[model samples]
Target chain A: MAKDTMIEELLDAWEETYKKGQLTFWVFLALKESNKCMEEIKEFVERASDGTMTCEEQSLYRNLRKFQNLDIVAYDSRKVSKGPDRKYYYLTTTGEELFKRFVERNIMIFTKESIINLLTQ
Target chain B: MRVFTQRLGQFAISALIFTVAFRYALDLSVGMKSFPAALVCSIVYFGLMFFAGWYYGSKDAVENEIHDIGFRFHFITYVLCIALGYASYFIGWNTEPLRSLNIGAMSWGIGLALHFVFFLFAQKNAIRGYVKEEIFQ
Candidate 1:
């Protein structure tokens, strides 16, 4: 029991450190899939991350706003069936290019044969 | 623009509160009881200042995360406090306005200058990689 607890604590610390700024990546991936409202984006992120990541609506909103300011995201006001107009957000061309380069440089390396073999082993 | 307007509205409300409180406190403290009244006024003013700063800081944190409301709030506080302090003296409400204003203004001015420097440094760091127009565009 004590060994299990120790391992769990170490994993938690490792995950915390590893996951920093990863929300940005997941959020971009969601937007890259399609133009989505905030709710849709939130759902997509949670589902796509295989339940490994969860984010508060408030933090998501803040990230979206920052992305908008950075010209990494843009939104269209769509008239929803209920209530006020909802903003459907999507990546701008700049954002798409940025994400592409980021993935190519940072994410795609893990898919290398050597890395995959090492991981599987 | 909308965010700026929202912040301006919040600032205006705080300024109005300060003006009213300062005037009322000064009026309450007449000749013989002036010292105690001034003391009460100072307490009230500082308290309101603290409340306004915290209240609006939190509101801005929630609503205006992109903008640096810290520097803006402190800058406004310095300006308003100095203006009010001197205005009271000119209007014959405060007799020793210079003495009253000196300590607070000097300390806060130094703090505000530091805040401004920090703001500039943060701005530089934010734009280090990207062109300003590109980011905005």
Candidate 2:
């Protein structure tokens, strides 16, 4: 596949997810910036929801709480602030490494056809 | 219910927050006040309100239109109050010794109180509408 084709596919997927109103984009974007505490994540979620997150939306956030549940993400209550006990999540080293790989792979797959055609002709 | 009132509320809240924060940050009551400081703060606060309100308003037209309206009206009022307060502080400091401090303190107190009132009005009006829309929809 050409690099442009791969990029197009990724964008299409993103749009689809957005239309579905999934919480994944907000979570992913927030994690991209920094290792956020739970409070911080909640604030970002509230903001992204445009001050309107349905009960379902809130539940979706709760479901994202486990690392074993989603291998790419990890949560640690100990590393975060003490008092009243709250868990904080951050992308694992492997998760960060995988995200980079995912980007590179898509780019290579999309661009490969052009590169190959150029080389042969 | 009117669009103007809605917008007024938003602007009032933003202005209040900006004023209170600026006053606290500058320690205007205690410090040797500078005209430049007051002028800069007022400009920055109004500019922020305009830009933020516009950006948020564009997201969803009907909802934001009301917010923008409220914000604009409140902002104008806020600017006037701040300008008056700043001028009084400037004048007092130049004219009198101990009296200047008292005048500055009073100005800051009035500004801070006005800001708090605006905040309450904004939170009640601006956020409530959006929340209701989301819930009912």
Top candidate on lDDT is 1
RMSD to native for every prediction? 4.9, 17.0
Per-residue CA lDDT of candidate 2, range B1-137, in tens? 23444544565566566655655545563365776776676577668766756654454344332333244454455564556446545654332344655675577668666775765576564443333233212
Q: Is the docking of candidate 1 incorrect, acceptable, medium or high quality?
A: incorrect
TM for every model, in the order presented, reads: 0.77, 0.28
lDDT by candidate, in order shown: 0.76, 0.55
Question: For residues B22-117, could you state the per-residue lDDT of candidate 1 as single tens digits?
Answer: 765765675546788788877887788788778777876666553453676777767876777777767777345577678877887898999988
Among all candidates shown, the one with the greatest DockQ: 1
The Cα error of candidate 1 at residue A31, in Å, is 0.7
In model 2, the runs with Cα more than 4 Å from the true position are A1-17, A46-58, A78-83, A101-121, B1-137
- What root-mean-square deviation over C-alphas does model 2 reach? 17.0
The TM-score leader among the candidates is 1
* List of clashing residue pairs for candidate 2: A2-A110, A2-A111, A3-A110, A3-A111, B7-B69, B7-B70, B7-B71, B8-B70, B11-B71
Docking class of 2: incorrect
- Candidate 1 Cα deviation (angstroms), residue B52: 1.6
Q: Report the Cα lDDT for residue A72, model 1.
A: 86
TM-score: model 1 vs. ground truth? 0.77
